[model samples]
Target: MYCKHCRQVMDNDFCPDCRKATRMPEADDICFLAERGHPWSDILCDVLKQEGIPFLRQSNLGHGLMSMIGQGLELESIYVNWKDWERAVDVAAGLFSEDVEILWDEEDELQE
Candidate 1:
């Protein structure tokens, strides 16, 4: 399977590169895209729409708190049916160079 977030080709379901669990969206889930921050996320969404891939953007209540505390964590995400994961990933990958993509891990503990 492919890691939709970082576009890594993983042997198992999990993406070792991104250190995040990967799963196909259930029939009822709308989360096709991973949690992406603003600006870039906005561009991605536009591209997805332009490509005619159906998806949804989801936000959590913590976003409000993050804004209030100025944490600036990106909770916004794009979602699509699991069935479209491949095409959706392809469309997203074509927009940028895979050689330079950076993967941000929120769950990583600070070494410092």
Candidate 2:
């Protein structure tokens, strides 16, 4: 398998490229779970780390520039492998509980 985070070929559950876990459940693959402005993104990342879920935080450089240019691009998002999507979501939901809102209104637009 390949690591969803670094796109490197993985020999096992742990990615040698990024040195993170790669065996995420397929059902928990909630790519682009939250936007950049949402506080939940950071919180969920932390929670995922604490729960041992492999995830990645991605942001569009253009979006950052747009934000500075007053165009206000969409927020950055969190992503996980297709395998890990549901478990990751569950972990986030368990951690954040009622605070788990759809921060990314744009849906799954993240690039792999």
Candidate 3:
């Protein structure tokens, strides 16, 4: 989500400007589905939403007392409701396919 004050992309639910949670709808459930990077995670979430599947994004923290005391490793991940898992995956795959096709068309033009 974009910050209201600075208009920059927010790192988490809380907007840096107002120090309040962004007024976006929360997902019904959460499941760690995919983890490529920030960009891919964002894209996947968007695809799921476009397909009417609800989801939430999350990340692992390291170099902290909580990390050392609780979890041993840090791993970024994305999540969707169990009910929406299959449909979300399908939608993400379709989005990827469309992106690939667009890239192919651009490449074909470059080749010509």
Candidate 4:
């Protein structure tokens, strides 16, 4: 177990040295759900927030010129706590699916 903020080994929920909260170590029983580059990822995240579920979002986006050229990198991964994984999965499936329909399309390319 380690504290993400302090990079120190953790024995409890709070780091002893830094006294900061540390996420529970991942165990065999721990579960997670991930969404990759899906436009609906934002909506799903909002739903999870509304439902009071803890989650982590890992988005991979390019910076500067590369990003502007490619509309940024395309990985937006959402991970949820094991207990909430099922709920998140249901929301992703029942409400939103892999093939999410484009709600609206607007071009916002920088013009300079």
Best by lDDT: 1
Clash counts per candidate, in order, are 4, 13, 0, 0
TM, every model:
0.51, 0.45, 0.45, 0.50
Candidate 4: clashing pairs of residues = none
Candidate 4: list runs displaced more than 4 Å: 1-31, 70-73, 98-112
What lDDT does each candidate get?
Answer: 0.63, 0.61, 0.56, 0.61
lDDT of 3 at 88: 69
Looking at model 2, which ten-residue stretch has the lowest summed lDDT? 103-112
Candidate 1 lDDT = 0.63
- 2 or 4, which is superior by TM-score? 4
Q: Please give, for residues 1-112, the per-residue lDDT of candidate 1 as tens digits.
A: 5556654344578877777876643444443456677666776777777667788876653756777866356557677765676677786777554555545434433533
**Tens-digit lDDT track of model 4 for 39-81:** 5677667667767877787666645644676643466677666
Q: Report RMSD (Å) for each prediction in the order shown.
A: 12.6, 11.9, 12.9, 10.2
Question: For candidate 3, what is the lDDT?
Answer: 0.56
Error of 2 at 75 (Å): 1.3
Compare candidates 1 and 3 on TM-score and give the better one: 1
Instruction: Using lDDT, rank the candidates from best to worst.
Output: 1, 4, 2, 3
